[model samples]
Target chain A: MNALNLLRIAVKALQRNKLRAFLTMLGIIIGVAAVITMMSIGEGSRRSIESNLTSMGSNMITISPSSNSPGVRMSGSSIQSLTVNDVIALRNQATNLTAVSPMVSASGQVIKGALNWSTSIQGASPEYLDIRKLEVSEGISFDESDVRSSAKVCLLGKTVIDNLFPNGENPVGQIIRFNKIPFQVIGVLASKGQSGFGQDQDDIIIAPYTTVQNRVLASTYFQSIFTSAISEAASEAASEEITRILRETHRLRATEENDFSVRTQAELINTLNTTMGMLTALLTSVASISLVIGGIGIMNIMYVSVTERTREIGLRMSIGARPVDILMQFLIEAILISITGGVIGVIIGVSASVLVSGILNWPTVISEPSIVISFLVCALTGVFFGYYPAQKASRLDPIEALRYE
Target chain B: MSKILEIHDLKREFKVGSEIVRALKGVSFDVGTGEFITIMGTSGSGKSTLLNVLGCLDKPSSGTYLLDGVDLKSLNRNQLAQFRNTKIGFVFQAYNLLPRTSALENVELPLLYNPSINTKERRERAIQALEAVKLADRFDHTPNQLSGGQQQRVAIARALVNEPVMILADEATGNLDTRTSYEIMSLMQELNQVQKKTIVFVTHEPDIASFSSRTIMLRDGKVQKDTPNENLQSAREALNSLPVTEDY
Candidate 1:
């Protein structure tokens, strides 16, 4: 028989039991939707993390002093062996480095006109803002002369500004007390929101390193040295150059281990991305199980339908329908059900992803490749599961089938 | 008229759990074109087996059967289906019209298997067949909407839609009442006399068998009797004498 006629007959048969056909398609619908939702969510989070890392400066690197004590383990930032001289040495020697700053931080209560807030106070050179990709929204940043003269000028991040000066007050050129020492507000850093670890990024106060070393903490050792490479591709070379300069400046012997650790932003981002990728793969695989189960459900229904329509097969054969025609009829019916379900699934999946993003406030991105792959998988499932049942229908004996009760 | 079907020493056997049961024991017969013949026998008399063999639905174990000069045993499954599509039409005892399908679509079914017929011609031929059966107004109605006799008529129309070489009907009016049975037989009589269509009908009812031009009685897997009806009854006259029912 011609394909169109066969299809029409198959459709007519399916129409006889519309509810059963829809129920059979339900399995495939749920499977495809689940896969799409899981994949989109995973992709969204990965993209979010990548954007966050770039915002924090992709080529930025941090160098912290490691504890020199033998057989003792300590947090690298707690050793405090890095000094202003080491930063100067690296700044002069590292060719690939675009900018470098010595960082010293201390937390203290700051008061501005009876508005008091306790926040971390960071001290660094003017290069700190450029290396960290921080911009001044108002007023001016502290210059090199301010760091050399130990000028008591500071910049406040948006969070610190909100906490210390409410009602969007302009605190520029105003005096704010930090540990009972009065400092002039130089500028307000632009907002950076929260970090990937959920920590508030814009909750710090910035001052010249000389002022924090002499007056706030009364210390000469640097806590950490932050630097940025000229370009993303130069990060590794810049890291190596900084490590060599620091080791030489500290005068560590060949046999002695260097008292420093260098970390690149790219490395941290890669580790985070790897973890996210694993999670996405794990979720997608789990969702695919439902698709396989859906295929099995189709097979189960097809077998039942073949058995139910044995007499029909006989009648068609007696009316001059070839075995191949019977087979094509059944096979086309299966494909029609699955492909219809797949199209519905794609719509449901996209809508569900949008709902998740809207209601739960989670990021979700639907990739084109995922939709294409899921559609192909659905078609393959129909063919694979429908084969044996269609074959059984085609191979039936006309005499016995006609006689079947 | 020329002979349309020739059979010689036709035999059919079935293995029933290690024992071979012979269904057709070397039965032979010839049917001429435009002839209306009936093969009559009781249950277990192998007349049904003979019908199946004649319809090309079952192969003979050891026999030579030819239709229009072509060997039946030489044809494969697909070729047999093709042969049936072009050369023979079947009307079952149950009517066997597909349930929930319109009578027009059911009539068009056999033509669907013929690749040479297009959709438009198939429809036109199905309508013509239905018109011949006097069921043109009921083309859109499903089988369930029709009476037993009407359903049988639709089945006959389906059988005739392909314009096959011969019509093979097995107990075509077995489910109908006496009056409806006469009505269907009259229609078959008109088709045989006016359209010159050859027909082979199988039934155990002697009264139904009296309408055919020839009668063949089968017994113990063999032909017990084969003879022309010397006093053939006209179903049209019989229907004219019967009382008309309110449903008709």
Candidate 2:
């Protein structure tokens, strides 16, 4: 018989018991839906994490004093290993770096009349705003001359402005006292909601390095150095260049370990991507177990169908249907059940992903590859599971099957 | 007349719990074209086994059986299936019409296995067979919607659709009432007389056997008597003579 007739026969048989066929397909539907949803969620989180890192400056690299430096180990914040001389060496010698700035921070209370607010004071050069992707919403930033002359001018963050200058008063060009020394607010920093670590990014103050060093902290050693590469792809090269410059400027011997650590945002992004990929793989595997169970369900139903249709098989055989024809009939029926269920599952999975994102405000991305893979898996599952029952029907003895009740 | 079936010393054996049971023991028979013959036997008399062999459904353990020039012993299982599809039609006691299928489709079943017959030709042939059985008007009715007599007619149409050389029936009237049985026998008689079709029917009813021109009586796995009936009864006359009932 031709394949089309066999398919028609199989379809007719399934139509005879529509409820049973639908129930048999339920397992595959749930399995495919679960796999798609889980993978979409995993991919969504990965993309959002990447975007968050990019917002913090994709090409930004941080240089800090290494606690594991040769000699007595020192704590991270108390380490006086980095200096302005190292920053100047990196700014002048590093070929891949586009911008560099030295950082010196001190926590103290600020007073603007009777309203006082306590926040950290960050001291850096003019290029600090560009390297960290921070913007000044109003007025102007402290320039190169401000850093050279130790000018008493600083920028107010959104949180400090909300507190020190309450009642909607603008803080730019106003005078504020820090550690009993008067300073003029040069500009207002734009709001940066929060870091990936859930810390408020706008709860700080920015001033020239010379002002904080001479008039506030009174320390010569810098806490850290921040720099930006020409591009995100060049961060690795820029980091290596900074390491070389710092090592040479610190005068470390060939056998001695460098006293500084170079870290790039690219490294952090890679770590997060690897972790997300593994999570997606794990979830997809778990969901495929349900698919396996669904296949087993198909096999079980096929067995029952073969048994129930024994006499019909005998009748067909007597009418000259070959063993291969009978086999194809039952096998095609099984494949139809699974493939139909797979199509429905893909629709449901995509809608569920959208619904999840809509209701929970979570990021979700539906991928085409997952849908394609699920289809292939469903087809394979049908063939693999349907073989034994179809063979059983084909091998039935016509006489015995005719006599079956 | 040309011989449609030639069987020589055919034997069939079965192993039941390590004991050999000979269902047919050295039986021989011949049937000519346009002949109507009935094989009569009680239960366990090997009549069913002989019919199965004649229908090309079972292979004889020994000896040769030929149907329409094809050696039944030499052909493999697949070839035998093809031979059965093209050469022999079967009508069972239960009618064997697929449930929930239209009478036309049931008649089309045998032609479906023949790759040479396209869809349009298959449908035309099925309708012609149903017309031959005088069931053309009920072609759209499913088996459950038709009477037992109508269902048997549909089964006969299915048998005739492929234009086989022989119609092999196993207790074809066993499930019908006396009147319906006579009606089915009349239809078969009409096909044999008008269409020139050979028929080999298996039955235990002597009254049913009287309708055929020849009788082969089997007993104890052996053919006890093979003889031409001197007074063959016309099934149309027998059906007409029966009194009409309100239930029918």
Candidate 3:
């Protein structure tokens, strides 16, 4: 028989078992939905990190003390050569330096009216806020003079303010003690909660580097050093300048390896993108196991259908249909089921992904290629898995099959 | 008379396990133009196998079979299907109509297999065939909804829709009551005689065999007897002597 007749016959057969057909379609639906949803989640997480990194200026670079920066791991004590003098040198000498800030952090308890918070203490100059693109919410930030004269002033992060002052009372100009020394709150840093590392990003207080060094903690070594390039085109030059300045300030003689490493925000973005892309691919692949299982289900059901309709097959064959005719009929039936299911699956998968993104408040984009590929894969699966049963139906002996109960 | 179908020394065998089971041993027959011939046999006598072979559903193990002067053995699979579509029709014991299709659509099946007939022509021919079988009013009724005799008539309509040279009936009335069976047999008889269409029916009942003009009996895959039904006149006289059954 021709293709039209075969398709008509197949559609009629499928309609006869509507419930079974729908149940089989459900498997493909769930598989496709899971695949799309997982990929969207992974994409959402990556976008979250991207926006976070973007909010902190993309032209920024970080310079930290390192040892040789080669195959061998750096011993923590061996990489402490970075200093404030290096920051001053880069700011003055580098042609593309926009702003330079030397960072030093101290984790200590702050006390006020029985409300205490073990908050991170960040020490930097007023230039830190401009380069890092932070805005003071309620009070002014510290200036260069404060850093030079070791002013007894502080800036509280949003989380620290909330934790220590539960009544939402303003703490600007109010005296709070850190490490048993009293310092007035000079500013309130802007809120930047939940960094890419899942850490509470705004849980800190800021102070002048000299004040932190002299009164808050007597620490000779500092945390990561920070700087910013003048423009997107100038980030590379600025990073190199920081490395050169730090190397010279530390007085690393000839035949000695530089102890500091400089990295750009663009480099961090690339690394993160590659890692998250791999994660997305892995998750999507894991979800494909369900699609394979759905293919197996189609194969199993087709075999039973062929067996059940053996007598009908015999009758058709005897009328005029050839073996190839019979084969095409059943194969077309299988493909119709799978292709219809795949179309429904694509719609359901995309919708479910959107639903998940909406509920979780995450960014997600479903690519068109994913939908097209899903359709092709599922239809081809029907051909591969449904082949054996359709062949069995075609190859049946008419004389014997007609006698089959 | 012009011969429409001729089978010469047809033999068929099957490999059942390690042994060869001989189903037909050189069975030979000829069907003339508009002939109604019945082949009678007991169980395991290979009459059904002969019907399948004649319908191009099976390949004879050896020997030649010709329908409308085209050697069936020489035709490829596709060619045989075309031949079956245009030149041969089959009516089986169980009324093997597609249960889901309406009687009209079931009758249109063979026309669909032949592309020369377009949709409009196919539908018209199907309606005409249904009318010939006296089921025109019930064209939309499915096979399951029709009674056993009506179902058989619908099957005959499906078989006749292609307007083939011959209608091969294999126990066409086997599943019906005596009255319904007679109704179906009368329909077959009308097609063979008034329509001048050749027919080959396979049955075990003597009364059914008497309806045909000739009889061929088979025993153990060979023809036991081949003779014209000279007693058909007496059988008709005796039938009229009995009683008037339902008109149906």
Instruction: Report, for every candidate in turn, its global Cα lDDT versus the true structure.
Output: 0.91, 0.90, 0.82
For candidate 2, the per-residue lDDT at A44 reads 90
Q: Score the docking of each candidate (DockQ).
A: 0.64, 0.68, 0.46
Model 1, residue A52: C-alpha shift (Å)? 2.0
Against the true structure, candidate 3 has what lDDT? 0.82
Query: Compared with the true structure, what per-residue lDDT tens digits does model 3 show for residues A130-197?
Result: 77778898888888788889998988888888888899888898998887788899888888877777
Better of 1 and 3 by lDDT: 1
Per-residue lDDT over B159-198 for candidate 3, one digit per residue giving the tens place of the 0 to 100 score: 8988888898888888987767777777777888789999
By DockQ, the candidates rank as: 2, 1, 3
| Tens digits of lDDT, candidate 2, A1-405 | 787778778887888789999999999999889889988998898898888888889999998887656568877678888888888788788899999999999889999999898888999999999998999999899999999999999998899999987799878779999988899998999998887667888998999998998899898988888899999999888888888888798888888877778899999999989999999999999999999999999999999999998999999899888888889989999999999989888888889899999999889999899999999999999999998999999999898888899
Question: What interface RMSD do all candidates show, one decimal each?
Answer: 1.3, 1.0, 2.2
lDDT of 3 at B197: 90
Which residue pairs does candidate 2 place in steric collision? none
* Candidate 2 error regions (>4 Å): A69-72, A110-118, A156-169, A177-183
Candidate 1 lDDT tens digits, A1-405: 677788887898788778999999999999999999999999999999888888899999998888766887898767878998898898888899989999999998999887999998999999999989999999999999999999999999988889887887798988999999899998989999997778898998999999999999999988888999998888888888888888898988888888998999988988999999999999999999999998898999999999988888887888788889889888988888888889999999999999999999999999999999999999999999998899999999987787677
TM-score of each: 0.94, 0.93, 0.85
How accurate locally is residue B168 in candidate 1, as Cα lDDT from 0 to 100?
Answer: 94
Q: Which of the two, 1 or 2, has more DockQ?
A: 2
